[model samples]
Each structure stands twice: as C-alpha cells, then as structure tokens.
Target: MSLSLNLPESLPVDVLAPDALEFDRGPTVSVPVRSLRLGRSPRTGGLNDEHCRMLAAAGEALPPVIVHSGTMQVIDGSHRVRAAVLQGRQEVAAVMFDGTADEAFVLAVRLNLVHGRGLLLSRADRTVAAARLVTSHPYWSNRMIASLTGLSAGTIGRVRGQLTAQTGPVGTRVGKDGRSRPVDGSSGRMKAYELLLGDPSASIREIAKRAGVSPSTAHDVRKRLQAGEEPVPRHRQVPPAQEPAAPERAVALPARSEPEREEPADPEAIIAALTKDPSIRYNNIGRRLIRWLDGCRRGVAECPGIVERVPSHNIDSVAALAREYAHAWGEFAAALEERNREAC
Candidate 1:
C-alpha cells in the first residue's frame, strides 16, 4: 500500500508584480497564489542537489516564479523548483505571471544566467550586452573594449563589424553632395572609427576632412565592400609629374707641358771620384758635391769642351808616379815596339 500525499494546486506567476518585487524573488509577476498556473517548460538547468539542500534548510515559503501565459513557458526561477524537488519538497510555492513567449524567454534567460554567472556565455546574452554597451556609451569603441578585456581587437571588432560593414566601401568615403575626394593612403577603418568615437562632434565629414579627402571619397572607401572588385590602388590616384633632365656641361682639357729629362746628379764629379777611387761607395759623397754636379749636368752638352784643360804640371806629376811604379809592371808598349823594329 502507498502513502497518500496531498499536493496543492499549482501557482501561476504573472509578468507584472503585484505587491513588491525583489531580485531574490526572480522576475516579477502579477497575481496571487490561487490564480497561478504551471509553466510548460518547468524551467530547466540549475539541477544541482546542493541548492535543494539549501532551500530545504531555509524552511521558508517558496518565492513565486514568473511565466508567460500563452506558451506556459517558465520566464524565470527555474532553479527554485529544482532545489525544492531535490529537497523532497511535497509542495513547491510559485507566483504566476503573464507575458509573451519572447519576453518570457528573455526573462528566463536573464534569471538563470545571473545565478551561475560563470557558465559559458549564451549567444543571446552576449549580443544583448554588446548592444547595451554600444548604445549606452557611444564613445566606447570595440578597440577600447578589446583593450580592457584583453581580447583581440579583431574579436571585438567582429562583434560589431556588420554595423559598419553593410554599407558600400565607397559609401563611407562619399561626401554629402556625393563627390570623391583624395584620402590619406595611411588611414584605416579602425583609425577612422576611433577618430569619430573620441570626438562626439565629429561626423563623417570631419573624418573625411582629416583624411584629406572629399566626404564622398572617404565615405565610399570607408564602407565595407564585397570580395569581387579590387580596391582602387591609392598609388595610382595621382600621376607623378616629370621634369626634363639638365643639359650636360663641356669639360675642358688641360694644356700640355715640356717633359724634362730626369738626369743623375753630379755625373762628372761622380765619374772623376770613381776614377780616383774605384772601390769607394758612391752613397758616402757630400750633399754639396752631389747638388753642384747635378746642376751642372742640366746643359752639359751646350757647355765648352774640357779636352785641353789638363795642366802640364799635373801631367808631369802623373808621369813621374807612373815611372816610379814601372819596375813593378810587365814590359811597356814602347819597349815592345823597339824590339819588333830591331827584329824587322
């Protein structure tokens, strides 16, 4: 035989709050305990036993859970039921609320999301958070968020990428009147975006002005473009003008000079000295003697002959010395001639 248990009627949770609303109560709802209804989804996730134990320990009445009427979906407070069930609760108290499926989905997600807070981020919440940040603080750019969060600038950039990406590449550069102007080759989308974000007074026109291009040009180039056509190369934007080369100058030749003959110094003096002492070294001569003979040889052929310059006294002195050493030599040429004549 099974023990009979009495279960109270299910409570309905309204979207609008009746008495008071607190964060602990989960999403606010309208209606009393008597009018509450069961949520179709019954709220999922938060299925841990620890929460159930805590709820059981509290020994307090259950707070109301918000829900949508049409879909009977749980909008918030899924964990409360899970906790109660885990604690062997016979009856789970809840307040019913009325809302559309979309509203209920958002509310339920926000409620369960804030509970754990450490789970992997949901796509909807991430998108909502990003949208909220961008809308509330217009000055905060993706790069700024990336910087603070230590995420790649590209990551944050891609988050809000399509906002500016949908427009044509040329749209961002076009002026109000729709004319193309020159843009700085160095400017990038991130840089331009930063410029506008930093100064609220800045418009597309201001950015175009700083970029040194017409508003239209900046507009067109700045907008996102498709993959088909190649970007108009900036290098070809302006044709570089060319100038004529300077005429060549005539270089004059240097005049020719008479080549002087390089002669040995003191030729005559060196010859005479060598004759007197054939065994002597030439480098030991005095500088004056070298210089004097070198100067004299400059026009030696033009000078008068020196064949008759020997004095009789010097010749006689030289003959007497020769006669004194005659006995030390072989027969003289004159003696040989006399002997040949006698033989003839």
Candidate 2:
C-alpha cells in the first residue's frame, strides 16, 4: 500500500520542504532481524559502535526501524537493526517505506540529519551526502539539498558548482514551493520581450506562457520597453561585447597622455584581451569593472551626438557631472599605480 506524505508545513524558515515521499505509516510490523538488508549509510565512517551498544542497552524500548518494503532494506535505523542483532533478537518492530531505492536513500539522509540521539553525521559525511544528492537529484534546488543534509545553502551551492563542472548545468530546479523554475531567466525575459513587441495586444499570461516566463516577468519586460529601456535590466543583461550595436553614432574621444609607441593600441583589442583572462572574466567584481569600462568606451564614442542633444540650460550641469566622473577615474588609476609600486 502506497502512502503519500507531504513535507510538514511547520519546517524551520531556513529549510525548504521537498515534494511528498511515498511510504506506509500504518501499524508497525515485526520483521525478522536476520532477514533485513543493510542499506547504504550516509555515514562515511560507517555505523558508530558506541551508538549500537547504547541502543542494545535499551532492549525492548528501542523504536521501530524504518525499512523499504520492496527490498526489506533498512532506510533510517541501521543502528537499531544492529542493536537488535546484538541483543540476540529474532525480530524487531519496523515501519515500511514504499518508496524507490533513491527515495529511500534521500529519506535516510534527511532522517540522519534531523533525528537520532547518537553521534550526528560529521561535516565530511554531510558534504558527501550532499554531493551524492546533487548527482542523483539534479533538479533539487540548493536549499532543498541544504535542508536535507544540514548544510548551509551557500555550501550546497559551492558543492553544486564543483559537481556540475563535471556533469554540466541543470536547466531548471525545483524550488521550495515545489515549482520548477529555469536556472537562468534571461532567455525567458528576452523571449517575453520579443513576444510583447510582436503582439502588443496580447495578454501578459499568453506572452508569459509562450516565452516560458512568469506573468510578472512578462509585465516587467513590457514596462521596461515602454519606458524606452532594454528588455532586460543592465546587471542581468548579456555581456556588453555580445550585445547588438546601439543606434547612437560613434565619435572618438580626445587621446590621453602616454609614451609614444610604434603603433597606436586598439582599445577593442585591449578589451578582448582582458576578457580572455579567466581571473578577470570569471570574477564578479572583475566582470562588473569590465562592463563599466565597456560602457565608458561606448559613451566616449557617442559623445558628439550626446553633447549636441544636451539642452542649453542643462549643459553646464551635465559637463560638471562628466568632469566629476573623469576625476574619479583618474583617482582610481592613481590608486592602482600606488598599489603596483607597493608590491614592487
């Protein structure tokens, strides 16, 4: 008999409840100790001998072990089973779990993390358990795995990064609410933007459904376009190098003071070289700096038209703001030079 058990709604705020597990929580049944199989234990160092001895001392007071109904494998109470054998017991009380082997393993990890009066799983053991779960349940979100393994969500995220480097990225993940969402929503937003542009009269829900995004995201995209902004926000947008050319005209800015060279350096070539460096390209701060620099490069190239478009009354204010930005950049460059000298 299959029983559906939804994760309790009373779980702590940090924990993300997973989808329901199938099990039989009916009356406990007696199963012969010798007939039971020892299932996989999340404990990398194996069962604690001291824990089994303590349980053995409890005698008949021992609680029922949870066993997988199909395989007669212990899912959550390996120590109890061991204690029963030590006590020369012919049979022990057991609750049946009707889930698959994978599900049983997951349940085992969850129980180990939360229950038992014995030694809790060590950090190494929990990490190993999380790594295994990442492999077996790629769709499970970091918080979901974190809740089960008793690891922080950030730790689980790092584990996911290391493991996925080998297995490749999971396109979608099941959120705490049990809904699957795309790992990256940029594509969905772009699609929604296109749909909205193609049919301005279409309902937000219709656009969202076709674009594979939430209705709220579709509405946001529509609002952004209406305001004459890009469909995706700046931080969330694709790298500047990959974006399509803007309609603004390009005009080279005045050259800065530098030592004479055989040939003038190409700013585009310099940017491309910086992008190829993994230390800069992959680092968050480095990437942000690159984006800023690229923006400045574009701004300088469009300055002629931008200057002409400035209203006569606001020109002084805009020029003052531009000078402040240039001063800030100069200070930033000097700081870098000072750091270089200090290193030397």
Candidate 3:
C-alpha cells in the first residue's frame, strides 16, 4: 500500500513547539519485536553489536524507535530492534509516520548521516548509497539526494546515469538548487525577456519579477541596452559611435592584506574530552561527538560568509573556540597517530 505524505526537502523544524526533534513525526505505539525491521540499507548501515548490547541493557526504558506509518518499516532503530530481539522482548516502542519507499530511503540515509551513532560507513560507501537513491526516487532529483545524503550532486548525477530508467515525466517544478523554487527558470527567463521589451524605462528589478527571472538577469539586459545593443532581440549588432581610440594606461594599486580565516573546530578535542568523562562510556561519547561534529560541519559548509552580513554577538564563545581549533587539532592528530602505532 502506497502512502501519501509531503516530505520536506529541508530539515523541518517547528518554531512553536520546543521538543520537535523532527517534523511530521507521529504518535508512539507498541510494535511486536519480531514485526520490527532493521533501519539500514547498503547505502546506510546495519546494527552494531556494541550498540545493540547497549540498547538491550536499556530494555523497556529505551527511547522509542521511528517507523514508517505505511509499511511499519523501521526508519531509525536497527540497533534497538536487534537489542529487543536479543533480549527476548515481545514488543518494541515505535513512532510511525506515512512516507514513500524513496522518502524512507532518503530519511534513513539522513538519519544515519547526522545521528549520534552514525552509519559507520566510509565516505565513498555513503556516497554510493546516496547515489543509488537517484534511481529509486527519480523525482527526488540529483541535488535533493545530494543535500539529504550529504553527497555531492555531481556524485549523485554519476549514479543516476548508471540506472536503467533514467528519464521520467517531469511535473513538479524543481529549481537549479534541486529544491522547489518560486518560479521555473525557463518560464521566468522568457517572462523576463517579455517584461524587458514591454517597458524599456521600467525598473530592472521590478521587470525581473514580472519576467520571472532574477534581478541580476534583468540588470544584465539593462546594461546591454545602455551599451547600444538590444536588450531582448537583436536589433542593431553594431555600436552607434566609435570612441576616439584612447591609449589605455595601467594603474598599480597597493596590495591589501586580508584577515586570517577562522579555523574550523577539530572534533578530536571535543571527542577526547567527552570520551574522558567517567560518567559517559566510550561508545556513548563517540555518538555525542558525531552529533556535535555533524552540527559543526554543517554550520561551516556555508563558509566565505555572504557579503554585507550582520555580526552574530550571541555566539562569541563558539567563534572564539573555532579560532583556536587548528592549533589543538594538530596535537590531537599527533596523539592519535602515536596511539595507533603503539596498538599496531
């Protein structure tokens, strides 16, 4: 049975509710342990023995597992399910929601990607899994899979090419960004051309909206018109007047120094510190490290900040720690290398 539910492309967050870890989650229910399924795919991963053991110890007190409302397929609890079965559990707690197989695949990939325990797969393996999703969810588009799976669109495209059925009916409007956009690029560009021709003196930005193109595109057309060329269709190919060919002079400007780039946080220090805590086990600490690192990695992905951005005063401590990251990172790496050699 196919279930229909709108799955958001971006990570959905509820502003009004404080405890919504994810959006569109359903109510919790008790499911038979034997009925529950594993949450990993070849693209994601299966349960770890250590993780299963930990969950088994948690018993009835373990956190609820997430399952698909349609198929009752587990989306994020392979370890927990395995543990319950091992512990002779009759039933396991689960949270169910409606979603497609494709959606489930992506959700599994994403959950594993950002989870505290993680998928435990190598980068290439993870990419291969995410890329395969392109074939399963064609409407999912290359970029959408890339974003959710944390793989590159280029990688996803390569995977999509390997599929037997690569083409399908394209109805849902997708942006170059791989997500839904305000307008389709083709129609928007055409509209921009129409609006540009309609009013030669109208505001470029305003015309861009009517034309369904970006303001920058409209501005480009304006500049072309100002340069004695037709903005839309080719009217006159030649310039009206040739300027007196003036000799160009080279001007030398003083070289400017730029501020040192902020260093990215090394997860090693955080990992080490968290691991050394007597209260937390190594496995639990590792999971927490993964969670924190995932957040930090995603935060730094948009680096080379947007131009004309306002300063963020609230995260001064975070900013300071980041600045000192590289220095401590070297020490952590060296120590890890030494420890590995000693073990070998």
Candidate 4:
C-alpha cells in the first residue's frame, strides 16, 4: 500500500541524506560505535552537555526516544551536534530544520537588525531605514511606519535630511499665541535644530505640534541655537504711557492796585494788574470793577457762577478768568459794536 502526506512547501521533509546513509532500516539498530561526525558545516551543532546528560538520564529511565533525521542540516546545529559528541554519547538525538546557507545568513542578519543589537539605529539611521523599507516592502507604508513608531512623516523625512544640510539659526521669537514671529526665514527653524541634535531630518511641524506651538515658533528656537545663543522664550512688549494735550488758551491775571497803576483803560488791563498782585482781594470796589469790566474779554461774569462768586480766586482763579475771557469775548465784541453804532 502507498501512503501520501501533505506538508507545506516551505517546510520540506527531506534534508535527511546523511541519516539515511548511516541507517538503512525502519527499526532501531544497536550499533557499537564511537562519536561519528553527523554532517559537515559550521551552522549545525548539537545540544549542550547539560541537555545531552538530561536526555541520557531520561533515556536510562524510559525507552530511548527516536531522533528525527529528516530536518537535520550539515551547516545548521553543527555546534549542538559537536556538544553532543563531546558528551561521548553513541547517538545524539536531534530534530533538524534546514535552509540554504545564504538564506540562513540573511535571516540571522535581519533578526539582529530588528533587535538593534548587531546594528545601532540612530534617529537618522532609523528614519533612513524606515524610508528604505517604505520603498521596498509592499506591506509597509509611510503612515504605517509613522503609526507603528509614533513619529510623523515630516519628522521621518527630516531625520533623513541631506548630508549637505547647513547648520543655521531658527527664525522668529515664540509668541503667547504659540506662533513664531511672522518672518519668512523662521520657517522650520526649530525642527532643523532638534534634527541636528537627534535626527537632523525630524519634521519641524511635528516638533512644533509636540511643543504646543506653530512650526514657525519651533523654527525660531532653531535660529537661536544656530546663532550660538541659548534660546529664551519671547513675549509681547508692553506699550508706553500716553501724554495729554496742552491747554490752548492762556490764564488771565487778577487786577492791579491803583497805588501802583492808573484806573485801567480796559478790563484786560485791570485783570492783568489784579492777577499780578497776588495779595489783592476781591473787595467791593474790586467786585464792582470786575462787574463794569464784565463786557471785557477778561471778565469773570461768563464763568461758572461758583467760580465768579468764590473770593479766593488764585491761579485756578486766573485759569477760570481765562476761561471766562474766552466765553465772554464774543459778547464783549458785540457790546463794542453797539457802542460804535451809537456814536456814529
């Protein structure tokens, strides 16, 4: 009778040429022998002495287990086989798996590469590798790499920036709004700096996003580093205080005493005299004079009633008088016109 079994193509049943040559029967044979080399190739080796010893002890207690020879490779498990030989066992039982030497070498290298032991991947190195994988692997995409690694696509690009990328300062000061200064040179500034330090190709936008600021702000920080200065955070400048406008009209003085001056011809002259002599009081004569000159430019009658009645009219009084002057000037001009008409 014939029997058929199905197995995966990748996992084949016969790398057992050496074992088939050594034993031609389907049943176990007791052959008195010394340690015999099973296969040629450095890759294949036997188990350590400890494992062999344990297996031997177990065999003594129970029936000797049959070793599968189908998967054994001359190049693979060679060390393990050698260790079994060193233990002086008549037969070292092993289950072997096989592949081409070049394939095995490549597989080893790739495994080590992923673990970052045989190869050290810097930020730049990782980005470059990821980029290469993105190009080569059908299953890998930029977004997949980014999502898996928690890096932005732009940052990944920066991590692999050109070797000729120049060193420079970032642009703009950061603002409270989390935006960099509105300057053209400031774009991607910070990203460049961080990339230079870690992965030079790191995306400025990503860094800015992480920093809770706009890309420009991050770039400004980069500029600071490029300028050979420590980067300090910036804020808006406070505005200066404003000054008030000067008064338009001049202050009018109190009337002068008759002792030093003649009866003033005009109300202005009287006011000037009174104001110049600070000691002069607003007495009955002074009040009457003030009233008679009420039609004049310097008259206090047109002022707030309280200002006119207040006797202690001082500098403020003079200013009030000036205000009054301005207020009465038109009335005084009309009165002068009427008088002139009467005379005509």
Give the candidate number with the greatest TM-score.
2
Q: What is the C-alpha lDDT of each candidate?
A: 0.41, 0.69, 0.54, 0.37
Model 3 lDDT per residue over 15-38, tens place: 113243353245556777666556
TM-score of 1: 0.28
**Alpha-carbon deviation at 49 in model 2, angstroms:** 2.1
lDDT of 4: 0.37
Where in model 4 is the C-alpha error above 4 Å? 1-76, 83-100, 106-203, 206-344
How many residue-pair clashes does candidate 2 contain?
Answer: 0
Local error of candidate 1 at 46, Å? 5.7
Residue pairs in collision within model 3 = 69-97, 191-211, 192-211
lDDT of 4 by residue, 93-168 (tens): 3222235543333222222122211111123334444444333332333343443233465453343343213322
Among all windows of ten consecutive residues in candidate 3, which has the lowest summed lDDT? Answer: 243-252
Per-candidate TM equals: 0.28, 0.57, 0.54, 0.19
In model 3, which regions exceed 4 Å deviation?
A: 1-26, 39-45, 57-60, 116-125, 140-143, 161-165, 168-199, 220-344
Residue 106 of model 1, lDDT score: 35
Clashes in each model (backbone N, CA, C under 3 Å)?
41, 0, 3, 39
State the displacement of the C-alpha of residue 109, model 4, in Å, after optimal TM-score superposition: 7.2
Say what the RMSD of model 1 is. Answer: 48.4
Off by over 4 Å in 2: 1-25, 115-119, 196-203, 222-344
Better of 3 and 4 by lDDT: 3
Q: Write the per-residue lDDT of candidate 1 for residues 2-120, one digit (tens) a residue.
A: 11122223344432232222333443333333333434321222233454455545555555555455544445544455555566654444434444554354345344332321121
